[model samples]
Target chain A: MSDILLEIKNLTVSVRNGKSDIPIVKGVNIEIQRGEIVGLVGESGCGKSMTARSVMGILPGPARKSGEILWHEPDGTVTDLTGLSEKALRDMCGLRIGMVFQEPMTSLNPMMRIGDQVAEVLRIHKLVRNREEAREKVIRLLKEVGIEEPALRYRSYPHELSGGMRQRVMIAMAMIGEPGLLIADEPTTALDVTIEAQILRLIRQMCVSRHMSALVITHNMGVVSALCDRVYVMYMGRIMERASTGQLFANPLHPYTRGLLSSLPRIGKNPEYLTTIPGNIPEAGREPVGCEFCLRCSDDERRCFFERPSEIETDEGHYVSCFMCQRV
Target chain B: MSEEILISARNITKSYSLGRKKRHIAVNDVSLELYKGETLALVGESGCGKSTLARLLMRLIKADSGRICFEGTDISALSGRALKPYRKRMQMIFQDPASSLDPRLRIRDIIAEPLRVWRVCPDKTEMERRILDLLDMVELKESMIDWYPRELSGGQKQRVGIARAIALDPELIICDESVSALDVSVQAQILNLLKRLKKELGLSCLFISHDLSVVNFIADRVCVMRGGVICETADTETLYAHPGHEYTRYLLSSIPAIGDDPVS
Candidate 1:
């Protein structure tokens, strides 16, 4: 039996314009071991969310995707999600894989009761035999996610709960199916700091107790540090760096990754001026022929501006894609 | 830092009617002071009345009770023509740069609107030169002067917003989560720009934010607010090092720093 739960190979997602295609997510590879929490960190439009959407078979309108999304089943069966039909993917989604989005209010139904909305996943998947069974399961899951008084609050509307409580309901909805893989895309971005800590803790707890792997997509490095075991730094549709959390923080090889870490305003350390990446992320399909970060990278050389750098293993289990790293 | 007060709020309170019989207090009996050329941060979670306090200080809404003074003049009660001059002296930068900027207007015209309304530059060439100079001050390119807000990135739009806020050389600027919408790298750039502008122009700022790390970076003083009331107020160093209020301590601890251990 292999430990690999999900493996994405040479994935590419693009959108068509009038006469041309704009590549949002270029060829990229990511692997998640069973029960491992990996982070995909990047700025907006950097294709982190698009990558997640590709795996879930929920790419937005006009976007086209290709390449392999291999899902390793518990019974030694390997299923390629990209080859699955719409109907087949729908069957596999809630039963095999679950996802939580950033905004709970928009993702959840405002008109439906919170309890019914959570139980709908079970009903669709046929996990519960009857309405009574669904209600009991939902109350238990809601309680597990830390909703105080699950039975009383089950009748409440989405608007009746606070932001943190709404997010808890979303988590319960995602967890009810008992999927092997959970994808959380910026689950705490819209939350307050105190509430964000609570949500992150809950996600980590859920992943650990169920022994499920998770792919957390976010731009906040702090969130990555707090939740992810391994981190992948993405920039302009390519993975700039990948390593374990400790190594990535202690020794960031990619200039882009280093720049991001340095730019963050630490809680205790107050520097006179924060280091900044000078240029904005280039428009999709207009990235430089060389390194995608070459325009803003301070360590760029002639080769860095002309040839795209390939991923190189600088140390054990640490990978970086930069001409500078290759030379060192 | 000078001890001279730039703007002061005294016992300010604001409440909204939730329904026919219920009321929600947004801001409650809050008092604050901003010294000359220093940044005072108002830190709190959502629904904590930080935004409402900012609105009260900006005179965007009338307070239920208490007074607000700018340069020793009580402007809370002033209105219409009498309050016109004070309005130019105090400007604001909003959270969402995309919506705060006029989408249809070009960058040049958007910045020039403030100058034209205030008659800062009446001559044609002078106005053009002034607009270009303002763009330069904010480190924006000359070519982007003709671009619309939709064509610009989030950071560039925010730069444009700052240029307009300072077009009249306002003495005070109220930044309502000004850098919250930007990415980390861009947020750093904007913060440095704001710091430089404060030093060069001697502008006092009321920086409101929910992110504590940001507040620690840019603010000289900090005020921790909860449920529409301030729980603690102190210098930034003292506040971060040894929080007096339990709520303040909890907020400082809740921040997820890079070096902190992952929740196991």
Candidate 2:
């Protein structure tokens, strides 16, 4: 029996722009085991968000999705979500798989009281029959997310709370569903470092305590280092490298991954010069020939410009898609 | 190592009235110095008043009680015409270049606006030449001078912001979370550019950021702030290696690093 909680296989997402269907997430593969936190890291235009959205069946209009998104349930039923009806996918989205976005200020309803928002999720899913029961659950959920005054805060509107508080409320809303897999897309990107650390800790604790798996999407390597067990480095919608967090950081194989690592401004002792990637990530659909990273890669070979490299397992579970790595 | 003090803030305190009776203290009795050709970083969490302190130093927002001196000249009381010259000498680069810049204007005009306001350029030709020079200094091609802010990448837009800030030859520049909005690669590019420009122009900088790691890379000295107060101040190396304050330690420990165990 496969222990995978969520598996994405040869997933391709494309958007129609004028005359052509441009692939944003091209032939990507990812797997999240039960109780594991996996990361999808990339710069802007790299389709990290697209991949997450595709999993939730929230792709924008004019976009097309193909391939399988296998979600395994506790009952041992393997559901190929790609072929599921819209109603079934919607049912699976919030109840089974929860999501948190980057901006909590906007993710939450500004008009609604915090209590109603949290309870609304439960009420919609028919998890709670009465208002009083939902209220108790909302306060309980708020307390679980580390809110100081859960009862007092339940009556408060979203605007009355701080950014960190708002994010916690969002987490409460997501967690009220008892989701097996939580997809947090840049959850802490907008938060301060201290608050981000707190949120990351909360997520880690919740994942452990609830036996929940997570697919965290972010560009911050520090976040990946702190939270993720496994990391996939995506470039131009394609995953260039995938390995355990320790292995990926210790010995990054792909040039793009190496560039990202070296480019991070460390906490102490600055390097003489940061090794920045030469160019920005290419726009989706207008990708370069061969490897998407070929244009910006420092060690690009002629073959890199002519042929796409397949994912090669360099070591046990450490995979890379680079012609140079393949050569070695 | 004794060097000339470029700018100094003494006992700066700022507060805002919440509703009718309550006053929320944004910055409380914070004091620091920016030395000639040195980058001083202010590190803190959001709502800790680091940005408010930056604004206070820039006189963008007035402090309740404080004395700010630029090269031994007390600029705390100066206003209007008296503040104009000081304003020219001290510039600021904001966090969001996209919003900081005028959306309707092209890149060249945006850069030249500061020069025009300061009367640094004599004519259109000189201003154009100076704008091209500034673009070159920022490592951007002159051909992009005609492009709008939306057309440029985040790094490029920041470069434009930098060019505008330096157009008047400011001695001191306050960078308020300048590179926080950029991607890592572009952030590195902007940082390198800033480092190079600081050296080349002998510029002193007051760098404010929530990201301690970025502060470590760019700042010579670090001031750790919390709840509107400066908890600790030390040289960057000393501060990072051995932070004295508990909050500083907390902040340091929170920074996620490769191979480091997660802070539980």
Candidate 3:
């Protein structure tokens, strides 16, 4: 079987306005392998979350998506997700793939018991035979997520649990279907530092134990370095750079990527000053005519203001798009 | 260096009733001191009462039993008009700038409100000049003075918040999770701005936040709190290098440091 579990090819998403289309997610490509944890790092309004939602076929209303999303099954069958019927897509959502959102409080139904919520995933996929079987599976899944007193927590509402425990329940719900691929959008953004560490560890452990793949969407580089094997830095709906986590951090090629890394404030070593990107992200559909990041590039050249730079492979599996990088 | 103390809170405690005769202790007998022209960080997790402590120090809410002295004068018992002069000396920058700013007012008016309330700037031209100067101090453009809060971005709104807080030339500013709502890059910009302003204006700050890494960057002294009580207090370097309390150690361990490997 092919090790490539999910592949995104030139995916684009745009919103329809009055006689115009506002491109939110420009053409971008990403690949996730079996048992690999990949990071999609970007700030707010950078389209990282939108790209993840597109992978799940859950783009919000009025947003039109295009391009190919290919899912390679363990049985050697490759399916194009964009061409699938609504019924087929619905079936594939829970059985073959799963997603975790930033805020678990809103994702979970406050009215329902935690046990029924996890069991509902199994029942919807027709994975369990009866109520007794579902109860046993739910208890085991809760325990697997490191929830103490599975029997007691099974009947507890989401409000009764703390933020960390609620997130664990959300993880249990997502992993109940034994999906081959998972998409997590800012999974630890709303959590405290201690709780964030636990959640990140839980996600990594679950993925490794199940031999599943993940696409972690976050703006935190620390989280990326700790959990992700590879990283893609996104900016204003486009992928500016992609490389292994170590390579990306050691030698960031793109100016935007370098600015982002340098702008982070560390604990001990305080720099004299931080390098800011000079300006805020451009409004959607109002990006520069040439390079999207040219407005904020400190070392902008003449060509950068007039011509868009194509993706250049600087090293093995390391890609960047910048006129300045091309000269090197 | 034995610096002059700016404000002192002695034996502060606060509590709220939980409907059925149960008392929820938000803050319990916590005392700390802020020095002149230095930053003191109050670090804790959610529901740890760091924010409640800030409110009590600012006198936004009365403490159950305590004495707060600002510049050697007890301000805890002062109320209404008696507190007006102290209010001008101590200002606050809230966490959510978007909500804290008045949406109907322009940036100029928003910043000039403090000066106008205190009668610091006598006339229109003086207020206009100070407003412009304040905007420039925060690195905001002169043209943004005419813009409303709703028209600005998150970082821009926060800059406006800082401009307003420093408009009255306050001696101390209480920044309650001021940078928590910002992105990393923008947070850096704001932090650098605050550092510059502190040096130029000789301002003392009480910065309250849940993120220890941020506290390490800006704080000269760190106070770790949990469950309405202070667990440890020490210099930033000492506290980070060798935590005196178990909770402080756990919090230090919990920060997602770069290059730390996730357990498989």
Candidate with top TM-score is 1
Which segments of model 3 are wrong by more than 4 Å?
Answer: B260-264
For model 2, the superposed segments whose C-alpha errors exceed 4 Å read: B260-264
Question: Clashing residue pairs, candidate 2?
Answer: none
CAPRI accuracy category, model 3: medium
Against the true structure, what is each candidate's TM-score?
0.98, 0.96, 0.97
Q: Candidate 3 recovers what fraction of true contacts?
A: 0.59
lDDT of each: 0.93, 0.90, 0.90
How would you encode candidate 1's per-residue C-alpha lDDT over A1-328 as one tens digit per residue? 4499999999999999989999999999999999999999999899999999999999999999999999988677999999999989988888778899999999999999999999999999889899999999999999999999999999999999999999999989888899889999999999999999999999999999999999999999999988999999999999999999989998999999999988888877779999988889888888898889999999889988889988999998899999898878
Model 2, B223: alpha-carbon shift in Å? Answer: 1.3
DockQ of each: 0.63, 0.62, 0.56
Against the true structure, candidate 1 has what lDDT?
Answer: 0.93
Q: How accurate locally is residue A182 in candidate 1, as Cα lDDT from 0 to 100?
A: 91
Rank order (by lDDT, best first)? 1, 3, 2
